[model samples]
Target: MGIPALSLSGLYSLKYGDCVRLPSGAEIGYEANVNFRNSYFIPDAVLRTVAGDIIAKEVFPIHLTEFAAFGWAWPEHGNDFMFIWTQETGVVKEVENPDLYNRLSQDLGETYFGASKDMNVNTLWIFNQLKEQGRFNSDHCNTKLLTW
Candidate 1:
């Protein structure tokens, strides 16, 4: 997607800011603010679709596979849970292991990893499905998920 251009007047009307969460869960304030000289227009519906697609992908792991089940059930039930696993850990994308991916996809069904509508809210559903199948350990990292 391209950067959106907003008209000077409309740009001035935009409510640009951020809601920061403190250690005590308190909002701080918004960041830098500025006014643009030109205005670029985009339809609200188009914006919503684009935003929804991004939310879905971000919520759903493109690469999902099945592995050994742990003592617990397949899908773990919790408020923030996304997927369940046994002992597997690492990248969950197809590029990690094509053969394993194919096998898991066959066993679980293609619908397991399709486009989602409300990923932020539905991630729990995906996690539940994974747990039900006795497979969790699945993970996703954009670029190897390097951490300090």
Candidate 2:
């Protein structure tokens, strides 16, 4: 059996910066304020091995209404995975190991333009689907099959 892992979640506003807490009882206090010029605000989560070696880092858009994008980095394997969820079309697309040049322009364009309708509230529903389907399992990451 795989070891239990920590999952962090929280809400942040201008008044209260990142108030997210990890399952281990550690908290991520405020760090920086959001910039309106930027198109996305990515909140991050880290997963470490039992020995304390960082295994993976996950980043996702803080606002569900914005373009649905999630990224995962595995330093051990030198690999990265990116996923974009389109609200309008209800499509989830993957851009494996995207590079700096195409990461935003091309991939994000495909995600945003491919959709036919907006999926504001449904973004959370999709996240629940991933969680329910065991996408957060350590085995999935260990086998390089990160589903979420």
Candidate 3:
């Protein structure tokens, strides 16, 4: 039997076309550019099978510009990837407690699937590519510097 894998649906934007406050009380400015729109961030995620089987789970930080640039310049025929950016300085990392991480991941997954039942294959491909690029490697702290 083939194992069912969880897929990513649309990203849920926490903020849209405005300044975002970081955990450090600092703010990241959102300048209007060719690549500006509402943005989404998945602080963590968990995957499961339809049979109520837990497949895998993970926790990490991601800031994608594509979700914000959807209508502006995204989902091109062959170009469906976006750049990931992170705060370089003056940012405090919120220590994710295990319980909170699990809860958030589960909630995010449920919310995402509840809103949209279909997954964008192209976006998933790009996300996998980013993973291969070490952008999502939890072992590497420098990966936090990911940006477009």
Candidate 4:
């Protein structure tokens, strides 16, 4: 998210599906990039419906809705501030390749989330967004200098 606010913020490559277990046993998802449309992954939700958390609840109903809101599409690695707080406590343990959010969203039964399931759509979105600013090139497709 916010690079863990570490002295070596840009050192580690935090990939999607990369998880850090909190001392309380909760696992938080690390959004590696915006190449894939990611969501707040509930590890134990039925595929038929999702989006019940407060973060989504403020925009979406407690259950499924036709008008689901999307994030700004700013191409951010994305920060979960609550997760960052837990990491700050120094009890977070880095883990590799756990069940990730965007990967699970692909299996959602709702048609409203169809776009998020497609990885290429996000890839193109990032490319176009950067290209408009004259920052994109063939050599920098995977570059992490994505934000202002």
lDDT: worst 10-residue window of model 1: 42-51
Poorly placed runs, candidate 1 (over 4 Å): 1-57, 61-91, 109-148
Clashes of each: 10, 1, 3, 0
Question: How well does candidate 3 score on lDDT at residue 3?
Answer: 25
Indicate whether candidate 2 or candidate 4 has the larger lDDT: 2
Residue 92 CA displacement from its true place in model 1, Å: 3.2
**Residue lDDT tens for model 4, 14-87:** 32222222122222222222222223321111111111111211111111112222221221244322111111
TM-score of 4: 0.17
Candidate 3 regions with alpha-carbon error over 4 angstroms: 1-31, 34-96, 109-148
Local error of candidate 4 at residue 26 (angstroms): 21
The sequence of per-residue lDDT tens digits that candidate 2 reaches over residues 57-95 is 433321122343333333335455444333332222245
RMSD of 4: 17.2
Q: Which number leads on lDDT?
A: 2
The ten-residue window of minimal lDDT in model 3 covers 1-10
What TM-score against the true fold does each predicted structure earn? 0.21, 0.20, 0.18, 0.17
Question: How do the candidates rank by lDDT, highest first?
Answer: 2, 1, 3, 4
Put down candidate 1 lDDT per residue, 74-127, tens digits, no spaces: 122322222222123322234446666445434432332312322322333443
TM-score quality measure for candidate 3? 0.18
Q: Which stretches of candidate 2 lie over 4 Å from their true place?
A: 1-16, 28-31, 40-78, 81-148
* Candidate 4: clashing residue pairs, number: 0
